[model samples]
Target: MTTLRRPEIGSTPEPLDLSFPAMPDRLGEVRRQLREWLSRCGIGADRAYDVVLAVSEACSNSVEHGYRHGGGLVRLSGVVTATQLLIKVTDHGEWKSRDEPSDPRRGRGLQLMAALVSDAVVTSDADGTEVEFRIPLDPRLSS
Candidate 1:
């Protein structure tokens, strides 16, 4: 597990860092922590909802696709800056490539994430896969 560092008093809060087993059951806890952290950063309800949804999609993909052979760890980290909130979901598992989803109702996680955030990027290699989201913050609320 990653140990989160405490921020200095009166300074910007530390980024949210979480490391957990990459399982479907852990998603609720991830969502809860993310919601709380974004709320503390003064993110409004609507935008926060989008942020959570987008981040969740990334985490879900990590859980579903990253570990084809066995289980691994998933790391979620978020940093809020004056202009944007940057969130990354990383998994330590072999990367799998699929041409298409076997089910017609699935495989849209990437699209949904991209639509919900200012920017979304996915990178994968032999070691693992990582998804990053950059969400613009409201200038008025970022202060």
Candidate 2:
């Protein structure tokens, strides 16, 4: 389990940094820890939900698509400023191209992420794939 440092109210919290094995079972733990960290940072439940959902999709993508043969690591990190929250989910696996045929019912993770956040970007290379999300903060929460 990853330990998160609680932040003082009305102050920018320390950047969130967590790394775990890229396995399906670990996602629940990741979501739990992330929710706790966001709550401690004073993020409202509604906004926190959006962040959590988006990040979860990214992690799911890393686990499902990033690693095709064996297990790897997924790193989830974030920073909160007065204006917005920035998050990155990274996996150390070969990048998978969308040009390849994918499940018809799936592949909407990117779209879901985009709808939930102000900005969502994905980048990949031989080393890995990273999905970054930027979600604007609510005025009341940033104060």
Model-by-model lDDT, in order? Answer: 0.78, 0.80
Candidate 2 deviant stretches above 4 angstroms: 1-10, 140-143
lDDT of candidate model 1 versus the reference: 0.78
lDDT (Cα, 0-100) at 83 in candidate 2: 62
Residue 58 error, candidate 1, Å: 0.8
Deviation in angstroms for 131 in model 1? 0.6
| Model 2 pairs whose backbones collide | none
lDDT of 1 by residue, 1-143 (tens): 11122222254557999998888999999999999998776676777788899899889888887876778899999987766677899998865577644677777888898888758899988778889887765554333
Report how far off residue 119 is in candidate 1 (Å). 0.1
Most lDDT-accurate candidate: 2
Candidate 1 wrong stretches, greater than 4 Å: 1-11, 141-143
Q: What lDDT score is found at residue 10 in candidate 2?
A: 65
